[model samples]
Target chain A: MEIYELTVHELLEKLDKKEITKEEILASYQNRINEKEKDVQAFVTITEQEAKEEIKQKANNPSKLAGIPIGIKDNICTKGVKTTCASKMLENFVAPYDATVMEKINEAGMVSFGKLNMDEFAMGGSTEHSYFKKTKNPWNLNKVPGGSSGGSAAAVAAGMVPWALGSDTGGSIRQPASFCGIVGLKPTYGLVSRFGLVAFASSLDQIGTLTKDVKDSALLLNVIAGHDEKDSTSADREKEDYTKALKNDVKGLKIGVPKEYFGDGINTEVKEAIEKVIEKYRQLGATVEECSLDVADYALATYYIIACAEASSNLGRFDGIRYGYRTKNYENLKDIYRNSRSEGFGAEVKRRIILGTYVLSSGYYDAYYKKAQQVRTLVKNEYAKNFAKYDVILTPTASNVAFDIGSKINDPLEMYLADLCTVPVNIAGLPGISVPCGLNSEGMPIGFQLIGKPFAESTILNAAYTYEQNTDFRKNKPEFKN
Target chain B: MQVSKEEILHIAKLANLNLKEEEVDTYMGHLEEILNFANIVNKAPIDGLEETIGVNEAYNVFRKDEIIESLNRDELLQNAPEAQEGMFKIPKVIN
Candidate 1:
């Protein structure tokens, strides 16, 4: 196999045996990007020159992932890299210092070679909302690799990068990973530090890993997860080595399948794919049962209210005063703030900012924002109840396989429905991983998510790891060409 | 719940976004639909439930007030659209 096609574990094994050099590994991926980037368009900046220089400097570093390349989602701050969140407002914004996650990855000797694209401000489910470019699904060019982490997922699926960092707010990372036939793991809310992540919704936003398989997800998570004084919401727990969770045994493990997920909008093919996995788990001595999670009905609504309200408040800082785009036609301070934002943000982002503003507006707070917070408590309580009976809960990552790029973009409400399956986890602040389950009739990939209790990333990772070992799904990698 | 043009413009003003003449109606429609959908949270039986701002429940996360070297001053202004000798220059506010 080509070096670019190898997983993080495989490449590390080869490097330890002295069978491959870091230069060869870099050259192989560089070649892949050259051949496939035009079709994939998964990056805002391909840091090839920087990666070449870092390979020599980081040589013989002690970390297990030394000299490996990883793509960073555009929203994560990387010092000196243009960390545009696919929005024109910050098109020229260069992060002055590394985010906490970036600092750890740098310390681990991983080369961040690209800034993956996403929805403008990480607000949309499809990357078409990006002000820069739309990343096409490597599985089929006409279809969108789900977003707002489409570029990260596409880059990994197309083999442009071995694994990439993605941020999930309302299903961004997992949806894209599922659509592109890759593994994406959103660590529990506080598990990973969020100091440098461009805040969308402070409560729900998390930095996660998008990789080819479950072990790669585990490896990347091990590097980025930890507490930090920089992020107030960071979990102050003991450090964990997530790779130790890759046990191939699920005997006596209790799994819950929430029936609400398979209701009306879920595609029959996607449901069948998850059912087959449930049967496989049952055969493997795991107990599987249908569970009720009626709170699923209000999750999407609650998610939007809390997410948008926080986003509106968080985004208020960008007013063409300190940094970011400025309007040339401004006559006064208000004009500069108004016109710069109006022109800089895309339509979807504008819609969200407005939605958020209204939700938090004077007369509507009790009806929307405050009520959503109360419902959020209920969502958490429901998950806590289910987690008590089940070690992990299973659901389809996305209701349907990736649709055509423009198919759902025109209708905002329809676009929000794409996140129906994955948004509940973010609402409850739990760890959820999407691993490829099977392919649909149209040949697009279907993903099944395994969700674990808060700070219990190991439980879901182990369950996913077990399922991957028994199924040939990991072998079904997407092949992309110019 | 049909949204009025005044209400849309009111929120837009609050958000500090200047809407184009043609885009206002479109945004108003989309915002209303989303808000109506989000209105479902009102029906939730949340009277007995306490608010969950975040899952960690760790409020007042305080650290020592010791000073450490901060980020470079020059690097922070590198991306500013308009920068002066030591600060970001913006449109005049004072009359």
Candidate 2:
């Protein structure tokens, strides 16, 4: 196998044995990027110079991620690197300092290969909302690689990078990973620091990983998951070596299959694929049973209100004052703020901001924003009730496989439904992972998610790893050759 | 649930945005649909439920009030669209 195609674990073995050098692996990935990037358009900026510098100044006492090349989602701040959140507002914005996650990754010796693409400010489910370019699914160029981590998933699926970082607000990472046929994990909300992540919905957003398989997800998580003093929301708990969780055993594990996720809107093929996963788990000695989360039906409504409200507040800082794009013909300070934002933001972003402002506006706060917060509590309580009984909850990562570009972009409500299954996990601030389950007749991948209790990433990782090891799903890679 | 163009314009003003004349109609439709969908939250059985302000139980992450070195002013101003003497320059507010 090509060095670029190897998982982080496999590459590390080769590196330790002196069978391959960091330069060779970097070159192999660079070659893959050259071969496939035109077709995929998975990155906003490819940091080849930085990667080369990293390989040259290799650390003597190498960490597990030492010399490994990984793509960072555009929203994560990397000092001196262009950290555009796929938005024109910050097209020229170079981060002044590394985010907490970037600091951790740098300390672990991981090379920042590039800045992956996403929805503008991590807003949309399909990368079509990006101000730059749309990232096509590597599985089929005609389809989307789900967003706002679409570029991260596409890059990993296309073998352009071994693994990449993705941020999830409302199903961004796992949904795209499901569409692209890879492993994506949205860690527990407080599991990873969000100090440098450009805030979408501060309460719901999290930094995660998209990789070839479950073990790679665990490997990356081990490096990035920990409490940081910089982010107040970070959990002040003991950290675990997530790599040790890859035991590939699910015997006696209690898994709850949420029925709400399998309701009418889910595609038949996707439903059958998840059924197969449930059957496989049952066969592997797990106690699988149907469960109901009544509050899940309210997830979409709650998510939109809360996410938009927070987004509106978080994004208020980008008013052409401190940094980012500025309007040239502005006559006054208000004009500068108004015109710069109106011109810099894309349509979806604008829609969200307006919706958020409307929800939080006088006379409407109680009906929308406050109501959503109360519903959010019920959703959390429901998950907590289930987690008390089950080790993990299983569901399809998305309602269906990726749709054609422009198919649902015009229909905002339809686009929001794409996150029906995955959004509930984020709402509860739980760790969830999407692993490729099977392929549809159309040849697109179907994925099933395993969501664990808060800070119980190890449980879901074990379940996902067991399923991946027993099945040949991990062996299936998108045929990107054209 | 129908958001009028006037309301959209008002919301845009609140959001510090100046929507184009053409974009306003499209936004009105989009916002109406989103709000209609978001209205479902009102139907949720959330009686007596406390609002979840945040998922994390962590509160008041405190540290000693010690001074830490900050980012270099010159380096920080590198990405500013308009910078003057290590300060971000903006349009005049007081005329």
Candidate 3:
């Protein structure tokens, strides 16, 4: 069997059984990276030495995912590695410390594949905003693999790695996974430690996993999901075995179909694909009910305001005088900041920074920023009410299949709407997953999302797994090969 | 349509970012549109509801306030692009 074709569980078992040496697994991944990376453009940097050393150490004692290669989103800080959030501002910047999640990944003995490309400062929905390069969808080189977490999603989709980690603040992980035709999980806010993630929108940002299948995603979540002292927002709860919840049956699961999620904006092909999945669920003894998350209609408006505001504040630390990139032709302090930021940030990053600052401005705070926060409470309450009644909420992961890279770049608002279905979960701090439901007329994968109650990731995983087992969607891998 | 070039400059300063003269006009246009759409959030009936800021509403992360040793000056300056004698090097501030 091809070593790289092995899933997380299979790779771990092989490592434990000594069927494949750590060096051999590393060589196989490197070979795949060498052959497929230029076409996929999934990674910003590939860490050959670090991965080799990690695997060597793990070869001594095996762990859950020991010796498995995983791609990391560029936004998460890895000690001594360049953690550029796909921005020129931090182009040469190296983090001095490992994020709390990175520390956990190290302890679990997984090999790092390197930093994957993302939207600059995690601002846009399409990966085109990345300063370095746009990551292509593995399904078709011309189309995009969702934004921000595009690289992570594409890497897994193209079979470069068995699994990868991506951060989701307003659907960065799920939307990409949808476009790439893989499984992505955005855990309940604070489910995974955010101590090391470069803050895009503080309250909305949460680390998640993107994998070839739901089982790998669950296994990845088990290793990375937990509380950390470094992140004050990290939930202080006992960790549970997420992998154990994978095999549960979804018979009689109450799935809610939010009326707003199925409305006019969704692509016709995508809608049909999701409806077919709903019918399948209904046939499997699960009850599907049409419900309304009333506040969801205003999700994009509320999300952008709050996210930009928080992003503006969180990104304040990247002054040129510090560790990151600084302008060379600056004469004074003000010039330094002005020129550094002006030259460093890409269009999308600058757009968000301006929007964020506008919302937080003195006179307009009440009308824009504060009201968005107030509306956020309403969105949260709406989810709470729905979750009390239904076991899970189902919707299309994105409004459409992956479009061409340049198709939405000229229209930022149009690009922002692409995340409509996934953003509400971020605002409400709920756990959501995107699994391959079906393919559209163009043959691109369309994902259906499952949102669960806070900390109810197991329910979402179980529901998705049951749907996956019944459908032939998993058999449809992108034609891209090594 | 509520945004203006002067307001854009002010907000940029607050964010410690500098915008180009040509770019400010474009940014002003886009920011205005987004803020106009954000106005819809004001109509949300959140009356009598407490504003939720953080998830789970946990706050006041007060530790025992124990003293931690600082890294040596050399170590601290290791990552700094420019430094001089335990101080970050910079152009003269007062112009």
Candidate 4:
């Protein structure tokens, strides 16, 4: 196998045995990135030279996961790197400091492969909304890679990088990972510091890992997850080496299959893939059974309300003064604010901002925003009740396989359906991981998500790892166009 | 449930965004659909539930009131669209 095709854990093992050097690993990925990046279009910026220099500088580092190549979503701040969040507003904005995750990655000796693309401000489900370019699914040239973390999923799936960091607001990480046939883990909210992540929805946004396998997700989590005083909401807890949770045992573990997630709108093929996954868990001595999670019905609506509200508030800072794009035709301050925002933000972003404003407006605030917050409480309480019985809940990562690009972008409601199966976890502040289960009839990858209790990333990762060890799906890789 | 062009423009005004003539219709149609979809929240059985402003458990996080080295002003100002004397220069607000 080419060095770039190996999982992060596999590469680390190779690095340990002197079979490959860090410089050699970086060179391999750079070569693969050169070959596949055009078709994948997974990156907003590619830092091959910077990565090569870093490998040389950190050759003697003692961290276990050091020397692995990883990419960052454009939203995550890296010192002097362009962190655009794939919006024209921040097209030229360079972060002067590193995000806490970037600091952790650097301190752990991982090489930075530069930034990936996303929806404008992470306001859409498809990466097509990116101001730069739409990332294609590595599995199929004509299909979307999914978003707003499409670039992260596509790059890792294409093996351009061993793994990459992605932030999820409403299924941004898991949906793309499912579409691209890779592992994506969105840790519990506040488990990872969001100090420098360009905030989309502060309450729901979380930094996660996209990798070729489950162990890499755990390994990357070990580096990125933990408390940061910079992020006041960051979880204050003891750091656990997530790699130690990689046991291939799910015996007696309880896995709840939310039947609500399978019914209505989910494709038959995706449903069967998840069923087979459940059966696999059952056969491995795990107690698996169907259960009702009625919260599934309202998650998307609640998500849009809360996410857009938070987005409108969080995005108010970009007024063309401090940084980002400025309107050349502005004479007064009001002119600058309106024109800069209008020109800098894309259509989806504008729609969200308007919707947010409408919801939080004087007459409608109690009905829309307040109602959604109350429903958010219900959603969290429902998930809490479920977790009280089940060790982890299982669901299809997305309702369907990756659809063709441009199919749903024009229809906003149809586009929102892309996140139906995955948004509930974020609504409840739970850790969820999407792992490749099997292929659909069209040869597209289908994934199942394991949702765990808050601060219980180890549980979900262990369950996903157990499932991965038993399934041959992990052996598959998408064929990049020659 | 019904939004007119005046309402959308009003919302755009509140959001500090300017919509082009055509984008107004596009956003209006999409916003109505999204709001209709989001109206489902009003029907949810949350009668007795308390609102959750945020999921993170941390509240009123206080930090030590001590001086710490901060990001360089020159470096930060380098990103400003208009900067003068290490400050973000804007169109005069107080006329």
The pairs that clash in candidate 3 are: none
TM-score of each: 0.98, 0.98, 0.96, 0.98
- Assess candidate 1 and give its TM-score to the true structure: 0.98
Residue A68 error, candidate 3, Å: 1.3
The DockQ values of the predictions, listed in order, are: 0.84, 0.84, 0.65, 0.87
- Model 4 per-residue lDDT tens digits across residues A1-482: 89988887788788779898877887899899988998999999999888878878887888876778889999999998899999999999999999999999999998889899889888777799999998999999899888999999999999898899999998999999999999999999989999999988899999999999998888889888889989998888999989898889999999888878877788999888888888899899999988889877688898988888898999999999899999998889999998999899988888888888889999999999999999999999988888889999999999999888899888988888678878888888999999999888778999899999988888889999998998799888897533
Worst lDDT run of 10 residues, candidate 1 chain A, spans A473-482
Residues A1-482 of candidate 3: C-alpha lDDT, one tens digit per residue: 68876777777778679797767777888998888888999999899777887777787655656677888999999877899999898888777778888888888877788999999988877788999998999888899888879999999888887789999999999999999999999999988889879888889999999988888888889888988777888888988988788764788899999999878899999999989999999988899999988876577799998898898888777778867788897878888878878788888888898888888888888887777878888898898898888999999999999998798887787787777899989998999999998787777899999999999998899899888888889878787532
The global C-alpha lDDT for each of the candidates, from Candidate 1 onward, is 0.91, 0.90, 0.85, 0.89
Clashes of 3: 0
CAPRI class assigned to model 1: high
* lDDT: the better of candidates 1 and 3: 1
Cα lDDT tens digits for candidate 1, A1-482 = 88988999999999889999888999999999999999989999999889999989998798878889999999999998898999999999998989999999999999988899999999988899999999999989999999999999999999999999999988999999999999999999999999999999999999999999889988889889888999888988998889998899999999999999999999999999999999999999999999988887699999988888999999999988888888888788888989998888889888888999998999999888889989999999899899899999999999999989899888999999778888989999999999999889878899999999989999999999999999998888675422
Model 3: per-residue Cα lDDT at residue B2: 70
What is the per-residue lDDT of model 2 for residues A101-204, given as tens digits with 9 covering 90 to 100?
89988898888889999999999888999999999999999999999999999999999999999999989999999999999999999999999999999999
Worst 10 residues of 4 chain A by lDDT: A473-482
Compare candidates 2 and 4 on DockQ and give the better one.
4
User: Which segments of model 1 are wrong by more than 4 Å?
Assistant: none
lDDT of 3 at A301: 92
